[model samples]
Target: MDASELDIVDRPAASARGWRVPLLAFARNPAGSIYGTVVADSVLAVESERQTKLSDLIYAELITVIVYWFAHVYADFLGSPPSGSRRASLHRLAVTLGHEWSLVTASFFPLAAVLLAAAAGASIQTAALAGMWTGVAALVLWGQLAGRRAGRGAVVSFAYGMTAGLFGLALILLRVLLH
Candidate 1:
């Protein structure tokens, strides 16, 4: 079972014993979840000039994003050596890295959407747009979810969501301007 689903009493023992550490790391650091989508957004904004093969675009987007996500996990795990024996340390690493699995999963949705659209004979450009917009939608949804947790009402939550989601646009702008 996933760490998050375990009863609360089990969590401490599980971590102490160096069990799968997904939820613990997530509770500690949520930033890893955005790695894939953020990298994809930056890459697509700067290099999405329509010359690449549709398959290349779809594959490259997902691969680059996932690779970068792994790098983040690696960096995070290494930067701080968690307390415990070698086994426990390794478990801690796994726990920390596993939280970032969400980053890969998040990127997968848009990548698949793009690939499916292109396979269905959509224009490469249109398929790409569909994929990018889908990612933006995901970001906005994350924002709304965060807002609700913070006790914001629906409209205010939407506003916050849009604001957070627009940060993706800024990333795009940075890529376009700087690269």
Candidate 2:
């Protein structure tokens, strides 16, 4: 079957009875639950290393942003615990990790593209073009995913910008403090 014609069904749906659907849904949607786990890991990595590069820092921030959007999307689509409830707090924390992961994933594409272009001795214009296209494409993909799952593309865009800003700030602070 042609790739476009192949109806990709999640196999886990078969066994997803009762609470399994919610759990598996969260698991499968990287933006949903998986994002939280990824952020926690990145944070821990930074904490353990005691230092990080600008690129790495931006990457972490971006991931956190995506993760936040994911959590927002999930909570919005599938009712969440009442705001400020213990359960809600816990869920938010987990979702935070997932956002971090998504942001990091998003950042990696652009960074890698730019670096590869530079290494190849491409012109400055070519490097910038590669980075810009890669970054935009990644964000668009994420936004489309967000739209499908949450009915909001703005959330994805917001997260992208917010993550970059926050992470960039943190990195600057860290550099100043450590330097």
Best by TM-score: 1
lDDT of 1 by residue, 1-179 (tens): 76666777676776774633554343222234344556666556555564368767766787887788778778888888567689888888888667667676667656776778888998766676566666677667656655665778999989866876786767655645764
* Every model: Cα RMSD to truth: 7.5, 12.2
**Candidate 1: which pairs clash?**
none
TM-score for candidate 2: 0.37
- How many pairs in model 1 have backbone atoms within 3 A of each other, for residues 3 or more apart or on separate chains, i.e. clashes? 0
TM agreement with the true structure for every prediction: 0.69, 0.37
Clashes of each: 0, 13
The per-model lDDT (C-alpha) reads 0.66, 0.48
* Regions of candidate 2 where Cα sits further than 4 Å from its true position: 1-9, 12-91, 123-125, 150-179
